[model samples]
Target: NDFPLVLQVGEEVVSLGRIACPIILTTLLIHSRSIVSTLFLSHLGDVELAGGSLALGFYNITGVSVMKGLSAGMDPICGQAFGAKRWAVLSQTYQKMLCLLLLASTLLICLLWLNLEPIFLRHALGAGQPTRAQWTSVIGISLAFGYAILACVFTNFLGEAWGKLYTQDPDVVKLISIGLPIVGLCELGNAPQTAACGVLSGTARPKEGARINLFAFYLVGFPVAILLTFQLKMGYRGLWLGLFSAQVACVSMMLYTLLKTDWKHQAKRAEELTAAVGERDDLEDGLINDSNDER
Candidate 1:
């Protein structure tokens, strides 16, 4: 009964208070970390803090736009398969979506990591700016993302499954499983790719649903992404520590979920449902559309 449920409700008021709720929440989440980083920067002097804030604002706008667009693509495919009860289609779509997102993340990591110095230099060069120190921070963030990013693909996977199982198809369950040790081992690798809690929450199978993505992107990931490019404590290393820890926590939860569930019956039901739907559509065959394909 506990899960990320999609709400469908009738329209209500669009009052100023209502309108401002999301906006206020969003701004705070966005600014919090960089605010902390900026506090650190300001102690270094005025110029650094101003540069940190400015560079961060610009990066947030660009990254949020892209992340939302991708969410649209993911939402529709999963929604339709789920509403229509098409398990095989859902599985196949996941495969394609994953491959595409992997390439996209790789490109995103490369572009930001490589251009961060130039990006900050352009904005940080203003008068009274903490130019060199801020530049160092920006460069650091860029390098931190270079680790192999498994990211949170499982979060989305689980979120979709949550809807199907806990809701209309309580009988539906996912067959795919990920072990805790392997998930942890992956986190420790040299590449320092995206880890458990955060990635799983944001990408693979977000339990709090897209809020995980929304929060991680705007709040957690955004500042982390920016700070890596903004400071020099351990250079790139210090910047990524918060984010790495977030993902590790998320991954552990997902792996644990896998071990505790016994819903093979759910998946079996979903599979049967797909076949039943196909049969009811009344093609030329009963259950065997392809004689050679029968299992």
Candidate 2:
């Protein structure tokens, strides 16, 4: 028997909200570190604020993004394992992911310590349920809209004076006024793209998300940024426009992928992934027990 359409949707919203709310809060809390640091930096001086911002941006690209991306890969494996009641597989997968992240972090530490150039670059699940995917998209898009509105309101309220909050330098304030709004617009794309990524994670298809990101940023976004920044002489504004373009491309692709996703297929894949790991765990356990018996 099927439930009413409204009821089904209501339930989905409630369920997704339950999971999403805590995640939203946790994300805000995590990023609050950087926010707080920026606040402190702003009080130091213009040069200090600028330097701190650059450092934070670099750390985000190299350190935080790397760890977050790698750790996200485990979401599907762990979610599926738990869903299937494969506790051992879940535990093992979690442990392996932690080890992987630790190794990645160590490598990143070395790279950050040695590298000179300003360089670059940059979920989980209901395990492939389409209803969840759709609602998640809706929620993400909704949040993006909300953010855009808030950004606009804040930017207008602060006007060119917004920069004064961070620095006494008129030049710095001018730059902030121009850049801040564009950054806000970019979130129009960033928010939804992030939401779509969550859906992809839940469905055990992080590789696809990665591919989309690569194509969107490198193939589409970067080229556009270059053209606008250098070719058109848009300068910093152009650079931000490039980011906006990238975000738009990324979100479009993400939403399209989610729309076209075959959720049933993903569910089957999740089952298989969890089952294979479960079997391996069982095999390992059996072997260990046999060794103990022999001893």
Top candidate by TM-score: 2
- Could you estimate the TM-score for every candidate? 0.28, 0.77
* lDDT of candidate 2 over 116-190, digit per residue (tens): 110000011224343454454565556656766686667656767767766777877888888888887887788
Which stretches of model 1 miss by more than 4 angstroms?
1-31, 110-295
The lDDT of each candidate is 0.38, 0.66
Question: What are the RMSD figures for all models against the true structure?
Answer: 25.1, 8.9
Candidate 1, residues 1-295, lDDT tens digits: the string is: 3221233111111222353357558668866777678657656654765687788777666664554445444433333244345556556656666666657657665232110001221122111123231332223223333322332333334544433322232322221122222232334432222222222221113343344335544666456645664654444443455455445444343445433433333233223323434524321131233323211
